[model samples]
Target: MTRIFSLTCLYILFLLSSCSIINWEVEPDNLKITYQDEELSEIFHDHILRFIDEAEKRDMTFRSGKVNIKWGPELANHVNATTFSNGIIKVNPSSVKINHDHLSLQLISHELYHLLCQPPSAYDHRSRHLISGTPYVSSLMVASSKKGEFPTIDNVEMWEYYFDELFLHHGDYSFVYDYESNSK
Candidate 1:
């Protein structure tokens, strides 16, 4: 009788451990991310957390849904990233340079902007017009460089400007010509 009881207790403990392991494996976080390369995973994850923190600082709240991100195939027009309405973001790995932290943050934050902002159109640049000065595009949503490049920010001030433009500004003042001139 003692032997049987001891074996039964061990079996029960094993079953409990197994159940917890399964739960941990299947549980989904707010952001369900998949990366093509394991080395990029941690870097991207840290950037994402920073993005969320910045958004919250601007009083922006994300809707309740698990955003799924994955490394996707080469995007059309050499874009670095694309976000879908259904909370999916695909990053083009080829466009990302592993050692460029600023560029990587920009790419991830740009896509997160799309996912969280849900602008009227996927291509909305949220351009702000000047009443009397030269019109310019300053938002992060503005099209990227046509040569598969993004403008490098030389200082923290420029980075802050882009972040503010993305989170605080609204309305599109882009002319038809602006659309053709900008590339993403």
Candidate 2:
């Protein structure tokens, strides 16, 4: 009887722990992409493919939903991109120009991270204070960026670090609340 109880407890614990584990495999066939500009569509599709490859390598799990990407009008508040909890991502092409391919990738990756992680509002953006002090210095989820702010497109190390932080540290929101506290 004791042996049975121990085994049942272990089984319950395993089931509970597995619930928190994310399944990182992504099916591209599950995604439905739409865009208004041909050039932007190509860039967007390439970014999504690259994101899937990277996610697979890391075995990162994203929330399960059919992703819908579409071109949106110029966003209010100077925002270039926005994501919805329902797996919709809208990018303002006028704000994210084709010449700025690196910026486009950054925006797309940032939005994708939001969709995949479903992080609370506290983790929405990496705080500037945290960025200055941590290995997450070049996090793509920085609240804002200038036209030429992104690293060169071929900077493998930087890109790798950004994705690593996005997938590996998505749950760490240490100093994020500190910023809120101080602001208030």
**Total clashes for model 2:** 1
- For each of the candidates, the C-alpha root-mean-square deviation to the true structure, in angstroms, is 11.9, 9.6
By summed lDDT, which 10 consecutive residues of candidate 1 come out lowest? 22-31
The alpha-carbon deviation from the true structure for residue 86 of candidate 1, after best TM-score superposition, in angstroms, is: 2.6
Q: How big is the positional error of residue 32 in model 1, measured in Å on the Cα after superposition?
A: 5.7
User: Can you list the residue pairs that collide in candidate 2?
Assistant: 24-60
After superposition, the stretches of candidate 2 with alpha carbons farther than 4 Å from their true spots are 1-39, 119-123, 129-137, 171-184
True lDDT of residue 73, candidate 1: 72
lDDT of 1 by residue, 9-125 (tens): 999999998966632222223445555566557657777776776776777765424567777676764777778877777877677443577667777887777766664264465
Identify the runs in model 1 with alpha carbons over 4 angstroms from their true place: 1-37, 96-99, 119-123, 126-137, 146-154, 171-184
Tell me the TM-score of each prediction against the true structure.
0.59, 0.66
Assess candidate 1 and give its lDDT.
0.60
RMSD from true fold, candidate 1? 11.9
RMSD in angstroms between candidate 2 and the native structure over all alpha carbons: 9.6
State how far residue 47 of model 1 sits from its true place (Å).
1.9
